[model samples]
Target: MGTYFIVREIQKDQETGEVRDGEIHFTDSNPYAIAYAEESIANRVIDLLREGTSLNNIREMLQNRHIR
Candidate 1:
């Protein structure tokens, strides 16, 4: 099997419709991000490296350190 790196844009709360004011995080074990990212990748709905999340882009995503 091959390795895959998934990138998802942090989204607001699905049920509450509340947009958290900080970075969103999901651990490596989070199944939801994995399953969703995988399906989206397979469907070609998003590029594997969306948001230019690669070694070369050099754009900073957030100012604060990771919460966890």
Candidate 2:
């Protein structure tokens, strides 16, 4: 058995149109490993935007925090 990674696109209903949420899933050889490692990266971006954090700044912060 080996491990594999899955990436998926999530759609959200909005007033203007559908939104894409960046979700990542990690799985193994098991067939039932659907969305085993879902990450709300898009939501995190929204939060960071709301907090006035730019992409570069976020990257720097992440680096400083040793968050790979």
Taken over the whole model, the C-alpha lDDT of each candidate is 0.34, 0.46
**Residue-level lDDT for 56 in candidate 1:** 33
lDDT of 1 at 52: 31
lDDT of 1 by residue, 10-44 (tens): 55988999874343332334443432223323233
What is the Å distance of residue 32 in model 1 from its true position?
1.1
Residue-level error in angstroms, candidate 1, position 21: 14
Which candidate should be chosen as best, given TM-score against the real structure?
2
Clashes of each: 0, 0
Cα error, candidate 1, residue 12 (Å):
2.2
TM-score of each: 0.20, 0.30
Tens-digit lDDT string for candidate 2 (8-47): 4467777868787554344444364322222343334445
Q: Which whole-number lDDT from 0 to 100 does residue 36 have in model 1?
A: 29
Least accurate 10 contiguous residues by lDDT in model 1: 59-68
Q: For each candidate in turn, give its C-alpha RMSD to the true structure in angstroms.
A: 12.3, 8.6
